[model samples]
Target: MADKSTNNIELKVLVDKESNKVIFIEPENDFVDVLFSFMTIPMGTIIRLARKHSDPVVIGCMNNLYASVENIDEQKFWIDICKDMLLHPCNAADHHCNLLKLKLDDAEPRRYFMCWYTSSCKFLSYDRNTSSPCHGGVMDREKSLRLDPSQVGNVFVKGEIRFTVTDDLQVIPPIASTNYVFTKLDVMDVDATEELTINIGTVEMLNLLMTSLVSKTPLTETLLKPKQEPKLSSSKIINQAIHIESQMFGDPMDGDEEGKISVKLVVSKSKKMVCYAEAGEDFVSLLFSFLTLPLGFILKNMKDGSLRGCISHLYKTIRDLDGQYMISNHHNEMILDPKLVPGFCYKNSLLGIEETSYYLVNNMLTTDRSLISTEPSQLKVIGKKDDSALGFLKGPAMFVVTDNLVVRPISRILELHILKDLNVPVTDIEDQIVHVGKKEALHLLLSSFLCDSVLTNTFVADLREPKQEQ
Candidate 1:
């Protein structure tokens, strides 16, 4: 009866204290069945069980039996085995814990060990010289733990541990989504009225217009100078009044359909000055377009009465001819003949004339010449003398010469007519002639041409008589 009872026990594994190796196990034992049952047990539970019993525990599977120890001397070996088992659970068919064949001359003491199966059993003893395969599949739980001293207060407990979950052992909260709203409001009650009165001379207006045309900067920025008292006489000053009014008819909160905006602008001249004014947004935009015109073109147009009547008054008021004169002689010492009087002359000097001396052959002028002698040599001598005399006579002849003139090529008669009509001083014309000679002729031509065109297009009767409404 005792033998039968002993036979029911599957295996007996004996460990040598000195060698720390599994020394013996029954051949026909049921140790493999006992080890296979441990395959389903959690590694943590197995570790706790091993820690409770000081003695070595014999486990077996698939005709293999091995002993586990919690020896202080082999603590690292047991810990490594436990970590491997936790990372890779052993299968019933392939067990990682196995008893190694004992050798007589082995220098190091052998230690019984067990680990999660990889391809074959890998003992955890230091002398086994075998690498653990669970490293590839092992979860780095230490890295996920918030165990740093700095993270002690920051660590948060998210939720209660759940054991019924099949897919996820650890749960992480998802980041929250956000939505934003933007709003814009419009003014509904507007009752604004503004009136501005500006009194500027034509010269100041011209300066401002010129600055706007020539500079890329805005007009407001260029006109940011300190206010100065009017230097021009009241007669030359132009009074401009600007009145602007804006009103809102309905509340904006009611919707865009209910809200209505009304704007009004009035630009007029005062009773003192006859100023030309334009109002409304379209006229203002058109005025702004004038700034894009070329500076030379703007100056040229200013001379014309088409832009503003004040410009003409300004021109007459500033016109002065203190010192001016016309050239009488050319550098080549050629003089105008007394018999041919020039139509236009300033200070007793012809308007346009150039002097030059050149010899001319008689054949070019006439086919035949009557020489005093009939002899070939004598006739040749006479012809040469005649040619020399003709050249000398032609040298100083005034035939309405136009090239290389001291005065500009513009019609002197026309300028005289305009100046007389404008009531400009004769001396002012002379000064203008001098100024033209000093500066570029093209600059003078631009002003003169624009003025002539404007004057020609303008009605003479209208200029002479005031309008019935005015």
Candidate 2:
């Protein structure tokens, strides 16, 4: 069984004496398990944890998006649980991460919920407070679940194996000699290098997760350097302008593949910046869906797999790592491309992500011992039949998405307040119609990862470019 009592993982880091840079880290399987777990974290979970810590790490415009969900009134959503889902998103690899030496994700253990009258109503829910559709009854009765120990043991990488992790977060076996490793890192003078041992607890793990998302050198920033002041919200970073020259990732939009929603971008005439967007439920839902995506899924969709931070390198390592080094085939495969947890995926999502088909062992779904069976029943979806539309917001409503991605219901007074806040005159602001297909959706995702002015950078910056004379 994996050691669940350990609080920290010890790591040996090599640092350059002159530049004070981390060369590489020699970590055991436990530490590697922590590294691999970064891929399994949902985007919303990352933002939530960042805000929880004393020194919060700003992850692009996610802070604004998360705040939008919080600031919006509970009555605006389809149900109360919709807001709960965004604020505390679930990780698909929760069970796998429970076996790690250090647990960074603090989400409550997965609980099983079913209708109060389970004998007659077969509906199941992850949230106990959800109102049942059958009888408007609360699905608060908890059911005991039995997990197979053998299936989840020995997490991530194999034990008794030595590995070398680069400062940029590349994992490789230590097949080469120490001198050869030094040569690869360009360490000519061994006297200039020093070794240090550090303990990685939950705090440091959270710091590493934040740093890895923004900085290229995570180990050096997380360990050697002092903590930087927290940039808690997007409002703090919205003053600066950034231009990201990146190739579009998805296929070109055809007539049939065009977007269902047409967002109106309000741009500044003089500054050439997007102030905000006037959109309906469909566009807001698209932005909200980003929180549900696993890190691996977003990285996989990017054809080139290049982002602002070292996450791309980590993804490549998962793809390149040999199967022999992993604990099990299932372990390696799941980490490479994780899916959204059940009930969280949108059916007509523009990004084209799907939730995994989850089923419970019906025989063990009951708490009573007498009801248990020697032979388990066939796997079932354990809930009311989903009609393919599992969304967070109600329809026919308008919302305002600011440059920083703060979302709120649209109002005439609010529009005037925003214009006054930006000192933007009505004459200076021009509206542009933009269609959000797969390609534009991918660009928005990329900008949200790297830029602070998400709406301006993703939609407005392109309009300023000179058109080619075809």
Candidate 3:
């Protein structure tokens, strides 16, 4: 017989440790349903609940009822038994028993334990002992019966919230918290629908409401709002001064502003003639192009046009035209003074001159002994001039012209040897005269001099048309 002082709920349940199933829950009640819900609760939460409610209580299951010991070791053993019965088993139906008893103090309400199970089942446990019954615990039986349809967990429903503007064009922003419940509707089975409810604030509500309202307004009305043009400071506005040069040839269609010249042009008018002049970009470009031409080619073209005379003739004319001319060539003829010439000149000395002449003759004989067919007798040194007014000319210079018309300077000693080879007498041989059979006289005519000048002035001009390699 149960103690009359204790309140008890008699439940017939089948428990199988192998299957972890509690079946045939007899006379099921709210407390029993809550307890069943905790069958799958985590072990850690159960351990925490056991620690919180350390008071000894009688728990009955599987035809067995035992007082839960408050001692740590006994409590651990009971917890392991509950865990094995609830979780580790394969099926509770296999180990079913008809009689189970849960006894409680009659002074305490049944809802106390029910609330404990309910709170322990949550992700965060609620303290049933410390909290008021109606405050944090499960709803009472009457309230649970009158539960709202929205409160039901396993129901399917859809709803929308709308904000409408009334007669007043002015709309007061919604201040109340709004909620949106997104649900997957099940047309075939309304009871199996899933829903997720989200609490929204005024901003989110206005954002959703404005989306539809904006679509009704004309787009042009929003676009027509006056936009302020950016104002640039005086410093930011760049003052660009663009100068354009006028062309020599004019395009009649172009405006005067486009053709205006930037460079200054000063044209003087004579008493008998008037000249029109324009010195612009085109004139400067033409001048630069002419300047890029080869100097020899330019001089040749000028001579051909009679704009410039022969260079030698010009030199002679300048010397004759200016009586005080200090410049003269080797032949005592006046020439244009060199703007810059070599600073050192060959020193004139009889011994020095004889040594240099001997060195030159020996070098020539050693290089080409065929210049003199026969050896010459030793010669005496003749009178030499140490005073020569010519700038680059050293006295006793002899010119030798080969058969190929190549003229070169030879020493007087070599000239004497050549004259002796020709069987000419030493007395008849002039120091400056170099007559040889293997050479021709290079005529010093004005036209020849002009040609020579042109050839000398002309730079390397291969001008051979490039032939592609086969």
Candidate 4:
């Protein structure tokens, strides 16, 4: 591995422009345990769901301190290795992990746990040994740095939580309460920046292993939510933030190899008077909800709540207000700037006579976000009735093809595929096929939207429902 600084353009340090690449990684890079390997357990539990909170998996990690050096030699060695090398399995870093250092409060059997281990995203910094950081970190040998974001870690499902913290490392903002890291206490409660004393390669390996062990258990919406009350006050939110990070759990395995990864619980700095609003909601409501709080006192409190990104239900009154809601690429600590996004509902007639633009933000389907181009002519995609005819399939909404024409269940992916297949961009919104002849345009739109259905002669039957004769 060579230094990235070797890339010299002009006299400037082209750190920003030149991409960083890693030259090599050793030790076979395998993060997952080989078959029959006595790896720490984090398997078999299903951890389905997102934006969830639950009790921590508790393991008597204090027993770890008891079984040191003399008792479990390899375990002790790894623990020492972790503390010294950092991210070494079970070594110097045992106390910091949420899984192993928690205190058990419940009387449940020591069978499984909910605590799953995940690491921060791939961290890159100047390393004297490497020119690029593109090295993969998984292999059967060495097992030093486990940095792959997608790797799964050992699973500890269904255990009660027991926590232990050290007095060392000089915790910035200081530890608050017995098991809480409040927003008021630290800005890094949700995000942190600091220098770590460990080889970058080694840290990557550990991250890979830790993330692999994060439980992939099946969790439902029922399990993802807490039975307790919702909407905590600023003080309570802060008080509850620190202890949210839990460590260690018991791994119970089923036959399946891949399971669910649980979303980690986190807290961030907010204002004294925190406001919650949905996408496409009124901006004045949001502003009044938040701004009405004394700005002097709000900034003075410094941190209390987190401004949630993409509340989904937020609706701003104007385009300007909507622009402030879309800033997902966060850039600051004091204030969170939301991405500019406007919501739309075809049924509400948000579109005008022509050339109205809107964002169709789906709660599902995250990948391949692209801009869609369609003509003024519309296509109607009808949802079929179930076999029993008990109810109609609640299909996707309508799309406008002409000023007065509209069609339901217009697939966005279909348009993209058509463009790709036809080898040309859609150049116009108004169709020459309208009035002159709607047949060709309708054929193109329908064929593109309804994948795999062959149309014979492109003729649609007139099946409009007519008024009953008196």
Candidate 5:
């Protein structure tokens, strides 16, 4: 068991002295559970936590997306809570994660709010100042979730079990012999290995998370040595662009016209690449909504290993594990097919992800009167009925989105400045309309994680001429 008093946990790692690489690590129940909990964290929460770390981990183009939300004015949103929801998205497995020995995510646990007037009020609000439909007072009273005691400590994997995790974040059962591991890895010399005990804390965990997204040998890059600058070769970028285009255009698209957002791409004719996109509020809202999705949900929707990251191995480890080794079938499902936090879904979202339904006992009152002793009744919280403002961003306005997804209000002067910065002649630029539906949204979500040239990789790949015979 890990020490509950401190943030650090001890892990035994096997390293290859010759290559200075981490071969694998044998983890305990607490450590394994904490690693598995990465799937439960929301993308926005990951970015937020990464920025707070001593060594910040920058995700591909997502940092710009997150900053766009931060730079936008509060009045641009329909309600203030809309912006807050994007900045601090709630995790679906918050209760399970809160029990982990090393708490990595700093986002506060979900707080429930109820109307103050009566115990029978049917409406519930995530925000404290939201008015109830029952003509009741402000929903400022906090209520605790009634969790089952038996399920309190029921985390990801079972206890007292031996497990082996590879450097790429692959979790597997105990191997038969160390000789076999070395043989499988093609390491012939047994003398070229060393064993070390690592003290993992919040900082190490954050580094691991960052490395898992970009590096194949995450453990070595995180624990054994400092991370080097990432290099994307031209051939590799072309291959990645081709792969992304195939995934984006090969799939059968949804035929729903209402769900499509029209975006005008500003292309550089000489380069045959997308310079930027001009879109309305709905398009920007859809892009901002990506941060609200849970990591598990994103992985589940992406084409297998489409997003370049070692975290997919961790996700597959959870998905392919035996049911008996997990706390419950529900726990396994929570990690494999996680949902969004309640009220985090936007109406304009093309991904078709649904928010989890929350049920509460409507017996808590906020007034100074005598406490009611009536029997508690479990009722489903009433969902928002009005669609006056279906998203975070205020509509009837235009916005500019760069290739790497830097969003800002559209300005003629700014557009001209961007053209000047690109140093492209005005005649060489052309406008083309692109329709983004469920298929394109999924494509963007996957590309935003793996590549810096999201628009070029997703939309402009087909326009480029093929390489000539060398």
Candidate 6:
């Protein structure tokens, strides 16, 4: 038999009479279950509690009014203190059990008067329409008037006090409406306007726009993303250093089976730039290294280890020739491959690449390109003995590693004697002089002879003619 002792109630007198140690005992339910039972009541459940100890109703109301204080003891004094407001101006009313009503009269700025209350009840406005009728909308009135302070009538006291006041206080004649007027306010209406109008374009565009709207993304965000900028390659760096571009030319020799490749290599980065061109195989090998790197991004990942292998394959064809860079197909030109022709201007992060290559031989070859020459003049002969005279090729001359006859004036020659180191050929010849008008004829002939094809080494003049073959 389960008894009420299982889960019924608790009552604690708490304090021990002798030692004053208080203890709590529950007769029915635990404190947790009792608290949860109060919390679990379905919402809107009417809890009609009787005056649970009389002062609690006033205390609850006061708690609702001033939530700033927490402890019940702190604000408990206010509940008793507010009773002073209950002193109604009059002790009794004219009718205790009957209802009192208010009606409005025509006034310019309408005002409301404190109509009627029993035993000093407070007057709050209510129009009969039920839904939020707090602001009184009395019918058949021009304006409702505010209650005059003179007729305040001790609101806390009971009274049948009325007055005919001269002026009005602050009150709206007719209350404003809270509900919205009927118009485009439904969810469907707003959503319809937001929908896109699909008449033209395509699904791609529509999907893109939808994505843009949903994500708030922009075209610049996708299209203008930070590009993986290309770097400038070594070949591209060298290519930019070449500006006045000249076209590749073919071998102009009368019966040669191959075409010649001519390209100018700028030797210095200074203002007085010097340039040289080559005729054949020597130019081919030099152009091979130049063509190794294209635009940076194209071959940026190519290993440098591959270059030696590629060059080795080329060396087998040339058989280590000095004047000519050997090529498998003599018909082909150096650095004149169609791939070297830049299709478009490369604009990358590091530097831009722009190169122009055209076939000059195909355009105008037979046209004479030499400067005009004049006839030589005669001078009086003299047996002039020179005490101090300089020999031909007084300084070392610079030449490109090619067959071209180009001589540079030595502003200053290199200190190291490379001819003795490289073991170049020696010549046995006596200096001969021929006088000419306005020209040192001996100097002119020797300079040309030093650059002649018979001279095998690149710069042979600097090597003194081996002491006259004994």
Off by over 4 Å in 1: 1-280, 304-470
TM-score, one value per model? 0.12, 0.80, 0.12, 0.14, 0.83, 0.13
Error at 274, model 3, angstroms: 99
lDDT (CA) per prediction: 0.20, 0.71, 0.20, 0.18, 0.72, 0.19
Candidate 5 structure quality by residue, lDDT tens digits, 408-441: 9998777787778888778999997777877778
Each prediction's total of clashing residue pairs, residues at least 3 apart in sequence or on different chains, is 0, 0, 6, 92, 0, 21
> Which candidate has the top score in TM-score?
5
Residue 301 of model 4 has an lDDT of: 26
Span of ten consecutive residues with least summed lDDT in model 5: 364-373
Alpha carbon deviation, residue 463, candidate 3 (Å)? 93
Candidates ranked, most accurate by TM-score first: 5, 2, 4, 6, 1, 3
Residue 115 alpha-carbon offset, candidate 1, angstroms = 73
Could you tell which candidate, 1 or 6, scores higher by lDDT? 1
Residue-level error in angstroms, candidate 4, position 207:
15
RMSD of each: 54.8, 6.5, 57.8, 29.3, 5.9, 50.2
Q: Per-residue lDDT for 86-198 in model 4, tens only?
A: 11111111111122212111112211111111121121211222222223332111112211122233212111211111111011112235335333223232223221221
Error of 5 at 382 (Å): 6.5
Whole-model alpha-carbon lDDT for candidate 2:
0.71
How many backbone collisions does model 6 have? Answer: 21
* Candidate 6: stretches off by over 4 Å: 1-338, 341-412, 428-470
lDDT of 2 at 210: 81
Please report how far candidate 1 places residue 323 from its true position, in Å.
25
User: How would you encode candidate 2's per-residue C-alpha lDDT over 204-275 as one tens digit per residue?
Assistant: 777877877666788888888846734523333331222334222133334563445678888888878788
Off by over 4 Å in 5: 1-5, 53-55, 115-122, 127-142, 146-154, 174-190, 228-256, 306-308, 360-388, 461-470
